[model samples]
Target: MREALCQMIERLVREEPGNRFPGEGGPYFTEPLIGFAAADDPLFTQYQTVIGPFHLTPTELAQHETPPWQPATVICWALPISEETRRSNRTETIYPSRAWALTRQHGEAFNSALRRQVVQFLVDAGYQAFAPQLHPAWREYPDSPVGIASSWSERHAAYAAGLGTFSLNDALITPRGIAHRLGSVVTDLAIEPSARPWRDHRSNCLWYREGSCGACIGRCPVGALSKEGHDKAICRGYVYGAVPEAVGAEYGVTSTGCGLCQTKVPCEGRIPAGKVSPLAVKPPEGESPSP
Candidate 1:
């Protein structure tokens, strides 16, 4: 069943634009059932210890924190960075070939299409889906917890969904590789979730091992990411500062801003590098691929 579902997801994503990244692409799909019931539950507190801390910190806006009680599932649909996007943005030049770049021109549109498709898929599958940002930061707003902002990190959703583990630079990497955009839907429905793949740090990609590779940490124009982890101030400042220039120049308009991280990881290109896609999933039964 897992392989069947994996094949279906991989096929759909391979046919889409801007999903392939650098190394390989997975039709990797996860249903994080645990997150869905995490709100107000002690059972999940221990789960957090296992999965690692949620990215929210005290410095973040009150509306952006992950709610202690909002138990939701995440579905990730990703692609590779395109050569044209890379050339246009000089991502290859900037990162020195560690990551792949997607043409900024198509990045936003492509991401939107993927997000919509995922939401639609969830609805069709009999689950309630929301952008997370649309919901209140928490059930109580007067004295919300730290980093309790309205916009939750899709990255957390990706992580909880078992898409990948965190790198020193704070980016998630799949078995396929890193450099992907993530979108998620929080739902109350109980669905089967993806099994945890990485037992510990040992199973993660080798580039993460200290001193072995620092493409992500070193590539940052600002020294935001490091051996300790991401410096949120440095990261926010750089990304926020870059957005105006990127928008003025009509570069990729992903709300998350500059994709320098995506450009530096050596993975399969977002689009298929070869004639075949590494992880294209076939449609279920007689159903055809969604447009």
Candidate 2:
């Protein structure tokens, strides 16, 4: 099942001509990494606290269906932005490079298509499956326990599936790195959960380990990031506000991206080469992690 899932993703990102960015450009994303998890994983339930109580668990999301599919597995995958796209974005100081903007606009569209195809593939195989983000009840919450959050977080879903861990920049640092997009599906077909090698949730992040390498912090144009961490309000204000005004027409994409922090960093394409900082085990006992 894992091999089949891997092939499905690779074929789409590689052979699908539509996978390319708009205009005469390189592919939006490259080699994909897939992972699986039992829908009943306890980590999903714990996200109610970490992300917000409003975040939906797999069973909760599955219940939204007609007869309610009995979800047994959660399939997750990471689509790394193609090197061509990342290279372009890495050169920019503020606004995302044109290629990066197009990737965010078109690349995400490809992700949505991928989700639909995965669901359709499972259904054709006589198994019930669906993408949570596509569900009608799926929504973003502005008044949740977390500042601004959504009903189901794909990053958290990937984490539970053992695809990656959280980073100081708030992006999931998968083995392939932090510069990628994630998608997942819930199905009745069961598969063995992927192995999670790290000891802590933020173990893959260099900053979290030894309080060193705040590379992403320097990349932020709005000072949204700091040694303390990311400021959702500051980051969102720029992404949803300034981006539309400053980059709207210039890039031919609106409110799509500014992933400066995700590029030109140690963890951009792979786990940073270094020793772990014992301090990054987890937030001190009383402090909760920001979504």
Top of the candidates by TM-score:
2
Compared with the true structure, what per-residue lDDT tens digits does model 2 show for residues 1-291?
Answer: 667767887898897766796566678888888889899988888888888778899999889889986799999989999888888888888888888878888788889999999999888888999998898879998766556789988998887777777888899988888999899989999898887666577778888766779999999999999988888888988878888688879877775688999999999998886775423344333333337
**Which lDDT values do the candidates have, in the order given?**
0.43, 0.83
lDDT, candidate 1, 1-291, per-residue tens: 334334445555556535444346422222111212222223233333333344232122223434333334444434444444443334432322222223332444555555566556666766555544334442322222422222345555554555655555556656545555555555444446654444432224344332345556666766776766567666665565554444533333344355565554453232112232223243112211100
Candidate 1 Cα lDDT to native: 0.43
Superposed on all Cα atoms, the candidates' RMSDs to the truth, in angstroms, are 11.1, 2.9
lDDT of 1 at 201: 29
